[model samples]
Target: MHEVASQLSADLLGSGGLDRDSGLRPGAARQEVAQRFASVVADIASGAVQFPLPGSGGTSQRFAALRAVAQRDLCLARLVEGHVDATAILAELQEPSPGPTERWGVWAAEPPGEGVTATRTEAGWRLEGLKQYCSGAHSCSRALITATAEDGRRLFAVRTDGPGCEPVPGTWQAIGMAGSDSPDVRITDLPAVPVGGVEAYIRRPGFQHGGIGVAACWYGGALAVTEPLRSAAQRRPDPHTDAHLGAVDMQLHAAGALLDRAAAEIDQDPHDNSGSARLRSLRVRAFIEEVCSATLCHVSRATGAGPLCRDLRHARNVADLSVYIRQHHAEHNLAELGGLVARPENTR
Candidate 1:
């Protein structure tokens, strides 16, 4: 899978596919990025690429693949990560795997707004209302979405091409990660298959592992953004530029080491028998988020605005990373981590 990511990155660069001047508009880029992601999904579906399942003892390899893709293009990585995560979720729930060539996404974002609601029907479950941040809205043939039920939150598997499923246009409007194609989707009476019991999605151990996977993508984006600074220091060898490079190197080194440790921990305790998965994820994600933020600052300060103004790829990377890392939930997640640590037993 890691090799596949490297090959995909090479293909994109060789074709000049992700360059802004590659004759693709923002909307066009969104479509193209989805296509790129689908092709990789096909690779995974086939025996061509073996995407490691979370907690399969190859968690580090899985994260490395995610990081590799993200290093090339964050938008593409976002879609790919969702697809893989959907597969992992299905496995953890003992659900049937998706058919080969079927593109999947996990849409469970619940902001302070109306979200999709599930009503139990004689035939099955029906979903209605609006789902925000539906990434791969235009591309995914299937999705594992969360909806509010009378009892509580539940996970549902719905075919995106089914009736009553509509992707609202003009809903996603951001320069950064625009190619992710995340928009508000409105569903009206869409039939869905319940994946697991209420709250099962979040309660599962893989949930924390998946969070670390996202941080891997962010770490990769940091690496991509750090390139400009690295190149500048190499060319001019200025003391200030070199200093920034050293700082970035140290931050990245720490982040990578933490990811390695987290992956190993997940492999050792796939079921979270130690009850520390959440804590591990919280610590790793928060640390990586800070590393990514600091990297952006250092790289920007060292390279100045020349790359942002002149290089389309670098500009897109910076913008996409800025938006992508926001998924960390800032202080809200930190507070949760704090609460967890404040436990009397946890402190010891």
Candidate 2:
């Protein structure tokens, strides 16, 4: 609701767009993104950045803000993912932390090799091994990481810039989402503070709600890709172009409406307290993913390769949205939904 966030979004979408070089190099882009995003967060207390989550608005409003941010720049949107998730996790655990100046990432991506394990030490809990998909490793000062402890899976917060913390650059090779800087990190006995007990991270109500928030970002990306086709259709009355535009319009509209519905559901039943959060999230994310895929297809087909071949921002939006929506687990997620739907209580 505040003008600061809207101004920032506008600035990002304007002349602030990245050049081809910065677009390709993630490390270079991450630092600027980190600083800008941290500024946005810091301005919250100053009545600048109006994040709807913990403020006057509810869950539904949060998605609106997320969608707006993601539509402007996908990399900028990536900045919000870890920070908000970590904040929620810490708040749920009721752990004290430094001021809002600190940025955080949630590193739950299971490492391909050895899992980061925690061992009890006189100082506190210490983490060992590697954590993959550590986005914002360079930018984020602190992180909430999931690791294997002696008892079971658990969550811990650690200082990424502290001793024994090492970010393994050149680990992420993908062209898309490269600006996200989601690289692997080698934690050689990094000191950690346990945020919650074993299984607490997974069992938290915010986990499912967080999944739905991601869908809002996907919806925004999908909507962004359709803009070119919208203009194309308006210029010429080609039935084929109009047909695709109509489809894209309908798809994006449905996606937006669906996001609104998901938000309303979340706000009415905060933290999935109704035991329906999982099913609701599964349906919302899967449907949004489907919309994103369809929008990408229809938009590309309608506008042809002109945008992808020429426009950097549009091309990046297409590329980034393609990768971001892949966070959708597809068949596995569908199977989980099917099982949930088959439950007698869910049926009722």
The most accurate candidate by TM-score is 1
Off-target runs (Cα >4 Å) in candidate 2 are 1-8, 12-16, 54-57
Q: What is the lDDT of candidate 2?
A: 0.78
The reply for model 1, stretches above 4 Å from the true place, is 1-9, 12-17, 22-24
For each predicted model, how many residue pairs clash, with residues at least 3 apart or on different chains? 0, 0
Model 2 TM-score on a 0 to 1 scale: 0.93
What are the candidates' C-alpha RMSDs? Answer: 1.7, 2.3
Please list all clashing residue pairs in model 2, or write none if there are none: none
Give the lowest summed-lDDT range of ten residues in model 2: 1-10
Model 1: lDDT of residue 54: 86
Clashing pairs in 1: none
